[model samples]
Target: MRLLEAFRGTAIQLPNRIAMAPMTRGRADDTTGVPHPMTAEYYAQRASAGLIVSEGVWIDQAGKSGPGIPGLVTAQHAEAWRQVTEAVHEKGGRIFAQLWHAGRVAHPGVTGRTPVAPSAVRQAGRIFSAEGWTDTVEPRALGEEEVGEVVRDFAGAARRAVEAGFDGVELHGANGYLIQQFLAGNTNRREDRYGGSVAARLAFPLEVVAAVVEQVGAAKVALRISPGNPENDIVEDDGKEVYSRLLAELRRYELAYLHVIDTPDTEALSYLRPLWPGTLVANLRSEEPTSREEGELLIGSGLADVVAFGRLFIANPDLPTRFALDAPLARADHDVYYGARLDGYTDFPAFDPDPAKFACSARS
Candidate 1:
């Protein structure tokens, strides 16, 4: 069968091709990782997407981002996530918990301790903390034993996600997090076995994948990666060869899908697609949205099986309906993209928010 056909047959079923990107809204209850009542209502509102990838959720204490960001290690976290998954599922939507470890991106004020990473180099950026946004400190480098502990943390988190009733788990390997920290050369200046060459650098992520797949079946596991993304100071020197080998390694597991974010041209996608050997979800930068006309072009031409939208999904809860009917889309408020609250998060009006506004396409 074709790649798109295979995606439709396996894993989560999508009512349409549109899938919501894993977006962070920071609405969890304090320290418990419980979704706020508003947060539950927010996701329930956006149930129109074929699949919803929940925000990046920390797997350990030291991996947390701020006061409201959730973690998946404890029973409290599981119970909280259960509410979220059940709410989305009730609305006929499938969800995946994006497993995350912030690594050096975390601040001591947030974790009440220094963050852990492959090396001691502090990320050259500020991180959100309870007090406020603060510069990241030099994180303590993980000893060889600590690496194994981190791996176990991820596996345990995967088990907790299953307990929480999520359809699957997507490893947070993108956006300069712990996994990306190891993948980058500048942040990882260690002489350890997990550092130095691209193959060695990928060891930590590969091990985490293996551990998670052992806990959850390979068909229920997906990984997200961003090549040449410097948003968080993630430099990818010779990223092509590095990602080529990484994709080859992923082929062994038969992952449910491989999601790549914001890569413009097809050069990297073309190079890595054959190596992946599974469903490909490409999230391109779309400013002027049109059924993801450009995105559909890529899909029809066979560059990707699905297209994930970030801001578009944020603004338009009923995006698939809007696309099919060519309805007007609500513009997203960038101010509320991060931090807490439901002003711009859940209160965004959809086509049928009120009975008067429900314009059936057949009405025309």
Candidate 2:
């Protein structure tokens, strides 16, 4: 099947076209923001994926979204992540760090820093924090100068990611995070150069891309965008104009790839696929476990160069093998989706076909 075929993308060559989607598994050190040692084994187990995007890693302390999320701000954090990258590399896998900043989505109770957005608007729902789930608050609006600092922070984080042994860095500009908060029409209500017209709203994300590319070369940089996604209470009225211009301008960088998230509400592929010429990583996002059929269709039809699977990767560490053999997939436990415990993390086993092979171990 095309899904299991080799990928010839310039960003990273692969034995197969199956890519592991970046999922926020709360298994890192909450205090130090370092990746847990088991993080290495967790990623290494799924090295068969064509490309693995590390979980959403915060760019700085102030940009932290919740407890247990990894960071790429300091030398210590880089050292810890180096182990993760090395482990993946040992298994012949290529991995990229997803540089993230939660922006208004960050709760002060979680990171001890006030959430900053393009505007002083409040999110209407509850968010995770130290005290558990709590009501979201009105975020502090970043001044023009402070916005420049955020851009610098992204560039700095990208440098740290390469030092951490990553093949590249994927800027988290999707899912209503910091970059999207600046790009989206509703959240960015400022009249400054950063937010006003189409160019203004696209300015922050474009600037972030440029800064990261400058830190690391364009080949070492990629971007993710979800134009029509409304997660985190985001509403985009002129998504077509915003994304059309954003993708058009992004052409200058000749980025490694463009990861796009598609949902029932958004026709991201129908509109975005034609705009991007580089490697296209398409994610058919859903809460349900991923099946080979979903990815096969995307790859067979040439809509996406690679398909990223999230929930399926949780239970099937040998997802590519199982896909090749048509093995029965395992169900993931939603309860343990986020936590430091390894119960629902690394405990998932590969698909074993020979029943007699484990007969003695099962009795023991």
Candidate 3:
């Protein structure tokens, strides 16, 4: 196909089309959500991807992550992120901070404050805190004025991302976070302008996108949306109306890409792709181990411009190399996925055979 031909040729050059999906490595310092030196090296090691979407980074303190999840809110966070982005850039990599706000998913114990959402809905799950796992508390419903403040927070974060040297920013409008919670009918039962009809329900998210686009440029902003896979209590009955209209509006902004998680029926991608004007990234696990042929086929057939590989990128530092050579993939360790230490985070070995390389790679 011309896609493969374009990618393989020198004249039709773009870097590698495979992208590293943002995976939260809870290795940031607990008191402050600043990334460490090791974090820079970790991302720099995997600079081969055409793009790297850094893990879900909190836009404001209210949506701050529990324990070790890094944030991009403060000057300190921006400085630390500068180091990370500079390191990746030195390695000839492109990166975008994935702006996140984990509304109902956040706990007061972690934020040291009240959780806010579209409504005072309690997520039916436990969130990992510094003390330990705790049941999610009911979030306070945001007032109208306060909702506008949150949108400003998103714009502020996007500006911070640019200052921190990111090539772009991806709004984490997926995975049942603040925006998704509001978008889904089951979670958001408000009678205000932010809820009710599907169009009204999507107001906040759409506004945030428009704000960020104004702060950054249209080509520098991307949106990630999961239409139907209810991961963190996001339920949408009229998924077609909500997502189809959402995509239609998104086309107006001329976004860099739309990253959509694959659903069981593949309804989201199937319905939205024909209408989307920008690049589309389809994220899903169609098989146990993703083959180069599979990724090639997707891009080759015009299904996606890029395929985001999650766990496989975690275990294999040289994922692009492995894909190019069609090597056996490594399995990621689920045990140490989160924490302040680098044990399972930055310790994953690279393709280098040198003992010192392995030694330097390992962390306690």
Instruction: Specify the highest-lDDT model's number.
Output: 2
lDDT, candidate 2, 25-72, per-residue tens: 999999999999899999999999989999999997888888899999
Model 1 pairs in collision: none
- Which candidate would rank higher by lDDT, 1 or 3? 3
C-alpha local distance difference test of each model: 0.79, 0.89, 0.81
Q: 303 in model 3: Cα distance from truth in Å?
A: 1.8
Query: Over the stretch 1-364, how does candidate 3's per-residue lDDT look in tens digits?
Result: 2222323321112376777888888888777888876999989988887789999899887897578888888999999999999999999988989999998889888989889999998888788877898888889999999999999999999999999999889999888898888888988989989998888998999999999999988888988988886888777788878989998888787777888877555457677778785678778644465556667777776767777877888888788876664455667767766677677766777676456754564431
Q: Cα RMSD (Å) between model 3 and the true structure?
A: 4.4
Candidate with more favorable, higher lDDT: 1 or 2:
2
- Residue pairs in collision within model 2: none
TM, every model: 0.91, 0.96, 0.91
Candidate 1 residue-wise lDDT, 106-159, digit = tens: 888987888898999877878778888778798899999999999999999998
CA deviation > 4 Å runs, candidate 1: 1-12, 265-267, 286-291, 353-364
Error of 2 at 324 (Å): 0.4
Best by TM-score: 2
Off by over 4 Å in 2: 355-364
Judged by lDDT relative to the true structure, which candidate is superior, 2 or 3?
Answer: 2
